[model samples]
Target: MTESDIITAVNEVFCEEFEVPLKELTPESQIFDDLGLDSLDVVDLIVALQKKFGVQVRNDERVREVRTLQDLYDLLEVIKREQTSA
Candidate 1:
């Protein structure tokens, strides 16, 4: 998938899984502060993302570094590239 596709899919997962408004999901939107997702919510978010992208991210160390919507998109893109190359 293209980068644009990844962004859209990631946003959709947040919207569908978390009930976050589509209008509030920007590149700079803080997943916790802006989206109101707490620690437990993050687990659900990760599960939803893994199901949506068909990738294993639950144990990925880089997941700890994600802070914004853009971060999640970038991470997914990197994972996609790594999977394809492997």
Candidate 2:
């Protein structure tokens, strides 16, 4: 899938989990500030993404890297590229 496609799917997961409207989502949206997602919610999102994408996104450092929607998109892009190449 394309980067946009991956982001779209991820947004769907976010919208569902956060109960936020799709129109409200933006790349700059902060995981905690804008979406009101707590740390547990963030962890749940990571699990959801891993389950849906079949990608392993573990490691404290990597988890700390995703602060915004754009960060998640960029990370997903990297994983997508790696998966395609594999």
Candidate 3:
């Protein structure tokens, strides 16, 4: 799917599951600082995303570098693209 579609899905999941307001979830919003999510929250987020997208996100170096909403959207875009192609 397209990046916009990925973003839309991410936003919907965050809003529904995390109780994060739609207006506050900007591209520049940091997951920890802006969203007030701790490490455990991040683990839960990853689990939810994996289940929702049916994609196994590797616990790799790149995943650890994700810091913002845009970062995650970009990462998911890559993951989804690879999944579809494979």
Per-model tally of clashing residue pairs: 0, 0, 0
Instruction: Summarize candidate 3's per-residue lDDT along 1-86 as a digit string, tens digits.
Output: 77888888899889988999999999999999999999999888988888878898756567898999999999998888888899
Predicted candidate 1 versus true structure: per-residue lDDT over 1-86, tens digit per residue: 99999999999998888778899999999988988999899999989989999899999999999999999999999998898889
lDDT per residue as tens, model 2, 1-86 = 88889889888887776678898789999988888888888788888888878888765366687888999898888886777799
C-alpha positional error of residue 20 in candidate 3 after TM-score superposition, expressed in Å: 0.5
Return the top candidate by lDDT.
1
Q: Please list all clashing residue pairs in model 2, or write none if there are none.
A: none
**Could you tell which candidate, 1 or 3, scores higher by lDDT?**
1
**What does candidate 1 score on TM?**
0.97
Instruction: Please rank every candidate by TM-score, starting with the best.
Output: 1, 3, 2
Superposed Cα RMSD, model 3: 1.1
RMSD (Cα, Å) for all candidates, in order, is: 0.6, 1.5, 1.1
Rank by lDDT (best first): 1, 3, 2
Stretches > 4 Å off in candidate 2? none
* Decoy 3 TM-score against native: 0.92
**lDDT by candidate, in order shown:** 0.93, 0.82, 0.89
Q: Once model 2 is optimally superposed onto the true structure by TM-score, how far is the C-alpha of residue 27 displaced, in angstroms?
A: 0.6
